[model samples]
Target chain A: MISIDKYAYNSRLRRRDPMQKLVFAMMTLSVCIWAEKIIISIAVIFIMGGMTVLKGGTPFPFFLRLLLVPMIFLLVGVFTIAVNICENQEMLLWAIPFAGKWIGFSDASLVKSLKLFLRALGAVSCLYFLSLNTPMVDLLAAFRRLGMPKVFVELMELVYRFIFSLMETADTIYNAQNCRLGYSSLCSSYRSLAIMASMLFIKSYKQSKALYTALEARGYEGEINVLEEAYESHWGWYIMAVAVNALLVLFVIALKSITGGLS
Target chain B: MNENILETKDLHYIYADGAVALKGISIGIKKGKCTAVLGANGAGKSTMFLNFNGIYRPSSGQVLFNGKPIDYSRKGLKELRRKIGMVFQDPDNQLFSASVFQDISFGVVNMKLPEKECRRRVDNAMEQIGITHLRDKPTHSLSFGQKKRVAIAGVLAMEPEVLVLDEPTAGLDPIGVSELMKMLRQIQTTLGITVVISTHDIDIVPLYCDYVFVMYHGMMVLEGTPKQVFTQKETIRDINLRLPRIGHLMEILKYKDDFDLDDSINTISEARIALKDWKARYLKR
Candidate 1:
């Protein structure tokens, strides 16, 4: 995982400005939400997946990881609707007597649940495609260029740095505990975790002071200086992204038209 | 007697928890000389170096740079700091920039140098430390030795007249230590910058320091040439530091011969030759 972040990969999608990817992600998500057609959502997912594969990298594991998160949400929605079938007021396609009431399942409810699940999956997939292709630093730089306040951007950078520093401290504490056989037994491991937490807090406080001193020595006068660059969105890539979004939009319009025509 | 680039007059500092770190310490750091502050842990060597760069304002007394007292004004301190570059003990703390190039250019950028000038200085400093290849690399990816070199490059880019280092070789392997020492010596000699080093390594004093100050119990106990201080075995031992290797070997030789010998040999080769010459003279007598 660390190596993936460290080494630069070749991808046209990766080279595009993060702001562009962010916009594309939002557009795809909104289209997925509005369009009730599963076919259109599936088409959008296929296009994003194709881009991942064509980037000449094995993104299958990352894709699986991304998919697993949304799968949980989909399962939750399915189970919630499945368990509360008793009070549902529609024509029953299936019914089972439970606790003195006819626990009924309807075709419309099932279809609604499945639609919500697919919409969520489509949205998550779009976000995964955007994040997996873009480096975080460049993304943050893009945010800075998007006219975000300097203080907020600097705070974000500092927070990112602090997370890594905390991780290092945690690693050191874990190693020290391991060396002392603190984790040899389950009881000892619990005790070690508590002690490590306290130690980590103290160490982090000291490190924060050291970091401040270091920053002051380097002439940090209350604000971090960030270089600004204009994100030139390529017309071709922008058009392609828009076209992908427009397909989903048109599908929604078609769905609305069909529903209206049926009514 | 020389112009004191940095002078601390009875500087005393106590931590917020009331632990006295520096007690009535006075020292004159001259320009264009490598002056080492030698002491053991808790002897207040680091406290003194912090004072040199205004990292710690003394609880009492004054810190003067170029005959002017350091004002509490932020602008004054920043200007003073620009003239006194500090290389911290941990390179990890010092080189925190995302990339090596940004880390090296940090002080330059802080000094508000022109973009082209900053780039030029960063390139020159990296070239000096032989780390130009690491320019675009993230700092977190570099090895400890490389990080130390980058930290030094960061400070060197500032082009300060006085360089203050606190245990620059601490936690370093022998090669890293040697590489750091070579770089420090080169910088001091070529640029004629005032180099103030605080270290626990006694052997480094004779080899690199033009003047040495021995600190004990939060005070500067002895100050003189390395030769003068190292010969005082009791004082060196009191500070929990060993005599330099050559001085230790000379002590052993003194028992065998009644001839006068200097206890200030700085290198192994010098000690070897001196031992051979002394033995030859003793045999003749």
Candidate 2:
């Protein structure tokens, strides 16, 4: 998460208009979910990966690592869908006898799980592409432009910024405790961790109070009305995004016609 | 009309927890001048600053801007804040936005300026603070000194009549301290903004501040130019503060070293000038 945030700030595509990025990511994601074809999913993955690693300048290995993060959950989830308990086992690829019946992988279930897993991964990659290029500030700004409620955007902005501060505070508290031998024993470790958590809560409360006063002093007047910074807007990026998504849709249609429906 | 831009007339604030942070703080901040409020820890410096722009309503007296008592209404507070911007000590607290550009634009945007005007001011503020290179950087990635500059820029973009910074150089390296103070001095004079800062960094007080107000126990212990304030060494020491390092050196040279030098020299340049004069006179004698 931290790496993603750092990359977002330094991303080569960071200057791109956030709304354009948001539109591109969300549109591709929805299409990827709707298409439900392994080929289309593969295409989405490659598109998002290429955008993030090549254009966005994120390290390819990092992108792959992030893509692998959800595979564990996807594998387990798809495993259940791929395996089934059945009385008739003619289509079973692998079977185990259990409870006077058979539990095994069937051809249809295996194909279904494969498509499901790939589709989910493709959707996640689309999100990664967006997050890897757009900083939280810009994303929140995009959301604000999208007519998300002011309070919600404000909360998100504050939460996003303070998460770093809270983590730093927690780290400092942990180090201070370590120097004092507060974590010498298991019992003491639990006590120290608990104390640190509570101290962080108190500290955060104080910080929020201070932030409120500071904001109020700056004519906050209850709304965090910050100017949206101008980004490099290009009609070419919009055209490319539409053309690419259109091709993905056409490919999905061709696959549906050729395979008589990938689902 | 009074020449003072900001005045707290016997202002008092007691927190809900029943702790009286200020008994009475009455001080007039001169316009277009750098005023340093000198105080030790928990000496009500922060509390008094909160009162400066009506962030904390005084329980007893009044806060005056340009000799007029502040209106605490919502609309009135908004106007007051536009004229009197306050920058806190902790950059982390002051910088609520992740992006430096967005954070700097907050004040200007809140003032309901045109979008183009807001952008211009934000860009100008970043340029003034020499953080235009950091315009795209996240707040978390900035170093302590950079964050401090961003916080000041956040207030300066508003183009306030008076900029109140609490401990503007609390946790800075020596060079960072000098650079930040110098930039603030430039901002004050160049933009014609009245700058008020509360700090324990006494050495810079003599070099930077035109007027000084010493706060002890929530009340003004002394108020004068830096030369006059630092010369009252015993009263400063009573308040758990001290003279500037150069002033202390000059004091030693006058009393302990039995050298004939001015008692009011608090900065290095003045000490140098005084020492050269002393040397010429002593050698001739």
lDDT of 1 by residue, B1-285 (tens): 549999999999999999999999999998888999999998998888888788899999999998889876888889988889988888767755565666677788888878888878888988988998886565666788888888888888889999999898888898778778878988999989899999988777888788998899899999999888887888788768888877887776665664466666656877878878878988999
* Per-residue accuracy of model 1 over A1-263 as CA lDDT, tens digit each: 45345432234455566787777777887787777667767876776666665662536666667578669768987767754455544466787777766676677667767777777777777766766666555566777778899778777766655566678779988999999999999999999999999998888778778877977887878776633223446777677779988876876687768788231
Please list the C-alpha lDDT of all candidates, in the order they appear.
Answer: 0.78, 0.91
Clashing pairs in 1: none
Task: List where candidate 1 sits over 4 angstroms from the true fold.
Answer: A1-16, A50-59, A82-110, A178-191, A226-240, A247-263, B95-105, B133-142, B253-263, B272-285
Task: Report the C-alpha displacement of residue B182, candidate 2, in angstroms.
Answer: 0.5
lDDT of 1 at B276: 89
Per-residue alpha-carbon lDDT of model 2 for B25-59, expressed as tens digits?
A: 88899999999999999999999988888888899
Q: Kindly report which residue pairs in candidate 2 clash with one another.
A: none
Error of 2 at B203 (Å): 0.8
True contacts kept of 2: 0.95
